[model samples]
Target: MQFIINGETVEVAADIRTSLLDLLRNYLGFTGTKKGCDQGACGACTVLVDGERINSCLALAVQYQHRNITTVEGLARNGSLHPLQQAFIDHDGFQCGYCTPGQLCSAIGMASEIERNIPSVVTKDLSATSVMLDETEFRERMSGNLCRCGAYNGIVEAISEATVPAAAAKTAGRASP
Candidate 1:
């Protein structure tokens, strides 16, 4: 299968059903994405697929063919950390750091989703002209991601402090996971 990992293009020969998470950690040697709750209940295996967050544990390696996959390690640029990563660090977003990777990737995607006006279950008054970041919207979108470290407060703060678009931030929220 051929896929773009981080910013590199590569090809691999593996079982079609192998999870992208396993291929990344075992075969590709990129272990940033964690394998918590292999059933996909936990967002530990989260990765950005074509700029959207997907639970790698639930996705097959073959399914990623020709798509861009961004793991926790991919968010950095030329040795510089992504803004979200820096924000997480600045806000002390993690204790154990096991779930930090997924949280970061999910935040980027969620922020984009909200910026694009994608409504979530908690979007009260969806008919409202703009999506606003509030406790309710933040919690609903981030419900899938979990943090055993009890760093929810800092995580939320980090995302809230990120440089999301002003229009997006008006409606999209940074919720605790």
Candidate 2:
């Protein structure tokens, strides 16, 4: 089957039952997307499919044929780290680093959701067109992804720093100043 991965189009031969995680890690050698629980309970196998995050371990490769897939390796550009990646390093958001990939991808996807004003369970004002990036929103959005090293504080800080600029800019545009 053909797949567009990290902006590259490639063809691979695999069984119909192969999970997207296995196809990416074992067949295509994109090992950055870790396989933690193999079950959907753990977000370690998270990856972006068309700018939305999904647990790759629970998705069949055939289902994603011809779809755009972004693994952790794709988060960088021109040899520079993605903003979230840099924030992760700057804030020491990881310890063992096994869950870093999923965290990064999930955070990015969460930012997109925020930009689109998609309300989460913690969002207090669902009718508001603009969503604020607050502690409650961040925690609820990132609850799917876990860090066994207990680096939650740093992870929250990094994601907040990386995503707050966009929210600030949007808010500033409506200011009276």
Candidate 3:
């Protein structure tokens, strides 16, 4: 099967039944996306499938053929860390760092959702094109990814900080010179 993983095109032979998580860690050797639970309950196996966060443990590798996959490894560009990665570091978003990769990927997808004005359960006005992401919105949206070390405070803080710049960039088009 062929896959575009982290901006690289690679082909590998694997069982059709193989889950994406297994294909990535076992076959392709990208171990950043953790395997907390084989089931989809835990978000440790989360990866962005065509820019949307999905639990890799629950998705078959064959199902993602020809689609873009963004693992934690792809977040950085030109040797510079993604804003969320830097925010995570600045806010101490991880304790053991096991869940950090999934958290970061999820945050990336979440930021995109916000930028597109997607509504969440906490969104007050559905008619509004853009919903401001406050603390409640962040917590509710991020409730899926679990952190056993209880780094919720830092995680929220980091995502909040990262989203501000993202929102600004979305509205302003580009950084001011």
Among all candidates shown, the one with the greatest TM-score: 2
Write candidate 1's Cα lDDT for 45-78 as tens digits: 8999998899999999998899989999999998
Task: List, in order, the clash count of every candidate structure.
Answer: 7, 0, 0
Q: How close is candidate 2 to the true structure, as a TM-score?
A: 0.93
Q: Residue 20 error for model 2, in Å?
A: 0.6
lDDT of 2: 0.88
Runs in model 2 deviating more than 4 A are: 171-177
TM-scores for all candidates: the values are: 0.91, 0.93, 0.90
Which segments of candidate 1 are over 4 A away from where they belong?
163-177
Best by lDDT: 2
Residue 158, model 2: lDDT of: 91
At residue 80, give the lDDT of candidate 3. 100
